[model samples]
Target: MHGRLAKSFKMFVLVALCMSLTLGVLSGLAMAQEKKVIRCFVQAYTPRERMEADRWDPPQYYWKLEQEYEKLHPDIDIQFLKPIVGEYEAWFVTQMTGGTAPEILWRQLGAAKADYVKDWYLDFTPYLEKPNPYVEGNDYWKDIFIPAVSESAVAPDGKTYVLGVDIVGVGIYYNKNMFAEAGVTIPSTWKEFMDIQEKIESAGCTPTSFPLGGAMSNPGSWSVRLLQDMMLDSKMMEIKTGVKGAKGVVKRTREQGGSISWMELVRAIKLGIYSAKDPQWQEQWKLLKEWSRYWQKGFLAAEDTDAYRLYITGKAGMLYDGSWQVKPTEVDSLREFDFGLFNFPKVTEESSPYATGIECPSIGGAGCAAGNFCVPLVVKERGLADETIDWLMFVTAPQNLIPLCNDLGSFAPALKVTEGVDPRLLPFIKQLERGSERIQPDLSILTPQYYQQHYRILQQYIGGRLTMDEATDKLQREMEKGADTLIDQHPEWGLKK
Candidate 1:
């Protein structure tokens, strides 16, 4: 009987060992599966409110990214969590400070500029030289992407924390068909542009159309478009620094660049950039008045989409929108009419060799680091971060860009003619290339403290808070205090020497 009991005990031990091994294998597999799935909070871009579709899903653009990437990487499944959209600064402070931030996520650019505009996000420096395997060292991208684009996306310290996925070049859109209707030619200089605007207005059509609701066409965007044209020839910023006609670029009223401030507008380019009694101060104010007079009575209150609708439906003659504005219309009635374009004409005697572009295209109508996704250095996983980088390279590959353009008529990659693109857009892209393609940063680029102050200055200029002189002078003081280092890091730009 004792021998029989011993045999049973041995059998029990064997069975228990087998079960333990089985459970161990299963647990390992489960952990591996968990690791393979990447959970990222794509801080919601296509606001649920703004979606052009009836569905509650994320934008087709994000789905399009996931579908293609999954085909290449079948082993990994990406789950995108959508964060609610609200005031980015407040939300970021709550989420990040609250310690519930996503493991993998896009840094809110507006919030980043407002709060943590520093090195905390993520650095893709080591990744760029060894960019995504599919597009590492792609010659087309290297050539097609202008240096200024990198200038805008990268901090002066040489780290890429953001990207401009779709570039915005604010050019003049005159209907060749409309010019034919009006019997006027496209202007070549700022002077000629004013004359053209006057003529277009005289013809009883809206000369230029834009909107300034909450923050759309405020002082920064409006000022830069004109400033981009002005800084090309003679600059008045030198008056602040005691220098001559300013050279190179200057942000925040040019005085930051050692360029004179409060100086008289050069007489030569009076038509394009200097129409007021004072070019430095009154120029912007005068232009705003001119813009106000040229637009419809209720234009200042129009939504951006409404503004575009006005232009597309033949109600407005000239529309000054960035490149994204030129696109496939959602409404069928608006898509038929063909629009023509020209870069805003030079305001100086000699047009800038490098004409700056006003590029802040929508990533769902608010600030998104659209073309940018940062991978923190501390992600520490060997292959996961690379996987994300590789995927980014795949989607933004110049070849892949054709589908994005065709799928939604959304963005025009700065290429002449990639396969499957509508030939009609080729000339427009070429014209954008001809225009100075510098990336123009908005007030967000300055210290967060300056946002209200800057807006106030613009309001003062527009709503008469300060005369142009008072506004410009006030701007110089605020800029010197806020963004001197950030702007000065790139010297030879006409800032304090």
Candidate 2:
């Protein structure tokens, strides 16, 4: 009878212990549910399924940063949302219209910049002025970035919206084995660059996979801007007219390399200071036409991917691309020969009589950094604004940014004190340092609409559908139209009359 009693008591004790443990688990889960979830719709540096699929060297720095941030603020939960597959702007607008946009958004600068400027995105100027607690001796958050990078975050209204985390540098990537076999060295001048292309073509290889045609006009547009900027460098000071009657406008010296404001560019166009009929402008296009012979046949219709494939397949001697291609090129198993990169050869008097011989301004500016993310106004509505800024500050801190960029093997950290930059990116860093400022008249600085129009016109000119005089006349008219559009949009510019 005593033994029976003992067994019954033991069973009762087991039931009590199980109930206690179950209650404890339920309590823990309830606490976890209370955490404020921050959803990040990020790009380029996202820690997505790529982490799981890559067998070697999964980029875990972003994950690590999240874990560390969560540990520091246990009440906050950071979640990175997967990228939307198509038309991100449309989806973003839909989500925002329904008041359900994520806390952090990526690539808010392109077509959506104009729309989002109407309070869809939070202005980061106030936060950028504050000290970032994550970085040592960082009294001001804005001081940590390269000046050009920090300046890039500012919108037309002079309010900063995005925080860029990395810098992009462009170079001409060449198959080292092919270059050696052709007995050609990296060219220093535009003339020599073309000469080498001819030699490479003579060696039975396509000179370059320089794609000029695509729905995405960036590939063609980028080279044109660089060449135009170089050819017209002597006239930049005349064109970079900051907002008329604005105070504290720092006039750039003739040799200074930097960007001009859209207002300044519009004003320049309206004043006829940046006319397409300018000989320098005409020469830039002529030189591009001259070089088109070395590009792959049907180059005008080739997409960016087509150019990349041509280079990777060893049929093309060189690939014109940015630093972002490093990791993919390194890992591409199909590329049997080693590859090297060099900056676009500078245009000199030998190439164009209008060449100022001033170094071509750096193409890889603040825009190259894909980490230019912005917080939605919805995040503020959800009372998570401060937390989101804190998270951004932590991620952008030089200590964290360096490793993140290095792990990706692309782009240099855009911090003032970045250390341990990837060796592969050293050449790009040199390029950035070589040209501290970009020149104008940059159609891109105006608007996506005008830039697209300009690129299309350029394609027509290069394809022999239009004469140089006809093209320049059309281009000048487009500039005038662009200026008129801006003037109408912003009556506040006080120049509408």
**lDDT winner:** 2
Clashes of each: 15, 3
Q: Give the clashing pairs for model 2.
A: 257-437, 258-437, 258-438
Candidate 1 per-residue C-alpha lDDT over 267-319 given as tens digits, one digit per residue, 9 for 90 to 100: 12222232223344344445555445666656546657776777777777777
lDDT of each: 0.50, 0.76
Candidate 2 lDDT by residue in tens digits, 109-220: 4333455456777888898889999998888888888776665555656676666667777888999998999999999899899999999999898898877786554546
lDDT of 1 at 334: 56
Which 10 consecutive positions of candidate 2 have the poorest summed lDDT?
248-257
Candidate 2, residue 259: lDDT: 58
